[model samples]
Target chain A: MDLKVEHEMHKRRFSRNAGLGFVLVGLVVLVFGITIVKVRMIGNVPEAYNAAAGLPTAEAGE
Target chain B: MSDMSADKSITSGFENEAGFSDYYALLKPRVMSLVVFTAFVGLMVAPVPVHPFLAFVSILFIALGGGASGALNMWYDHDIDAKMKRTMNRPIPAGKVTKEEAFGLGCALSGISCILLALTANIFAGLFLAFTIFFYVVIYTMWLKRLTPQNIVIGGAAGAFPPMIGWAVATGGVSIESVLMFMITFMWTPPHFWSLALFTKTDYADADVPMLTVTHGREATRKHIFAYTLPLAVVTLGIAATSIGGWSYLIVSIILNALFIRGGWQILRRDDAAAEADDYKAERSYFKLSLLYLFLHFSALLLEAALKSFGWGGF
Candidate 1:
């Protein structure tokens, strides 16, 4: 009975720590995903802005 | 009977043996994430465009610099970490990694990041990176952490520098936008961190670290939290109004600041007994919320910049 209780407590502790780890990893992924998406999306805007300003787009070939 | 008990103890202890994951915990990846995001925002908002290759290099160096600071912070605080329940499981105290290893990793990464920044970007950005490492490792970790309750208030400047470094990487010089980015972070650090300190007073006190809660008492810390938070909200909104940010950012800023102020006000109203009774759950939740608040605010700025470039609403 004592052995079983000890094992159960250990399992609980492990699960708790693992849960915290998952939460942290989730937060990191959320921030990283947002950053990458925003960067890629915004990255092309400068070119579009230039094009709209009547300047030849850099990739449009001279 | 005795032999059986001994075997049981040994096996149980082995089961709890910590490893690399524990060491990684000491690096404070969540804080590092904010540093990287804000730095990326600064890089994106700069007037000059950096080559994609160079931008990648700059962000990489900034992240490494952040990790180096974390490792060094753990190395210096290992003694206290052992005492604090919150930090007692950290690698050094838990015997997962040696202090020497952490120190070596910190030193190696710091040197590599600084030199790489100089090579890939400009000397100005590299210099800022080196100064940030020095400030966090030497000034904050070695000196201020043990010496004063105000350690984080000043030490927080180290984390605030990444955006400036990112800006420098792009423009090769500092400008008002970079300064505004720095100001937003500089003001935000005190309230965000001190709230955690307020809730974790026992751990800090046990560790012999003079956090505000330990030095000034919970009531005083609560007052200070609200005080710093008011200015922080103002700075956050102020940054949104600048040329680097636009309407989407301003709207996000206003909403986030209102929520942050409400949280801070809630913290101020709670007494030490009430805070302790809830296991500091309120403060902990608020701290978590603050992290998301800053991330969203910066992300909004990036969104606004994108909107402007597409000939949409620039204001």
Candidate 2:
């Protein structure tokens, strides 16, 4: 009975480690994604976006 | 007594063998990358600008739809996949995952991606994606894959739909640019698969998939490749003439198609006995180059779109 309980505990610990690994990878991807989005939104569109959309040449809104 | 333990050993072996990675492999990430890149170009080239986050979300769902198609394809094709030496090691055929699990995953992802795309992008984008998934899984995999030698030719629409869906996400409608993008991919698929079939017909034959090479012979398949590349060259030029293209794109298209046609001609002109003896070098090189051809065309389009957006190139 004691051996069986230790084996079960070991399985639980392995699963916990796997769960942590997944979360770590997800966090890294999320960070990278946020960085890319920020870089793309640097207000450099200016009036170029407006002229293209035919929205009366002005700064791109949003 | 031994039978139960033997069964447990088999079951436990598979249980440990299948993991998160095996499930991800079922998504066919290489195929998904092509879908994502083409769809990204479509979205980028559209006249309307989608917010970065929204663009990301739209592409995420599109890739998910593609993955759903792949899982369903694996589920349905597992039998033939097991027979084909090239595909015998896929998730299902390798016994890492069950067909029922793949089916469930596909169905779930299909529903989630379709509904989430509708919520995130326009209804038209969502509908097109849903249709793409259904066409790949049912029209291509279920009915046509086993039935026709021209399966890739007709069913190529499934891959071609991604750019159209991406365009719809931005503009909520199709235009000459999006349709031309679709046409480029559509016309390119036959030669692509046929080139592969030239080298791998044995796999198709063993699986009874009736590929062009299996049905018509390698010589005829080579002739078909040469024929298809002719119009494919013209279609590439046709895309360059659209509003989304410019001189740079036109130049790239011309050069790429010239090399492509030259490659096709070499494959068509290769001495069959020599190829048989030497392991089909011409066919293999042509197959590898064909992979680069579509990507270069789309990349050139992306360059044009970038230039035009920055108030410089085009016309």
| Top TM-score model | 2
Q: Which 10-residue span in candidate 1 chain B carries the lowest summed lDDT?
A: B14-23
lDDT of 1 by residue, B60-167 (tens): 778878888898888888898899887787788888677888988788878977887786678999889989989988888888888899987877787888889888
Off by over 4 Å in 2: A1-62, B1-17
Model 2, residue A51: displacement in angstroms? 28
lDDT of each: 0.80, 0.84
Model 2, B1-315: lDDT tens per residue? 475565565456335356566777888999999999999999999989998877887898899899999999999999999998888889899987899999998998899788877866789899999999989988999999899999988778788989999999999999988998998999899998888877764677778888887788788988999999999988889887788888989998898899899989988887679788779888888888888889999998899988987897677
Q: Specify the CAPRI tier of model 2.
A: incorrect
Per-candidate clashes, comma-separated? 0, 0
**Interface RMSD for each candidate model?**
7.6, 7.7
Best candidate according to DockQ: 2
TM-score per candidate for chain A alone: 0.59, 0.56
C-alpha positional error of residue B157 in candidate 2 after TM-score superposition, expressed in Å: 2.0
Q: What is the C-alpha RMSD, rounded to one decimal, of candidate 1?
A: 9.4
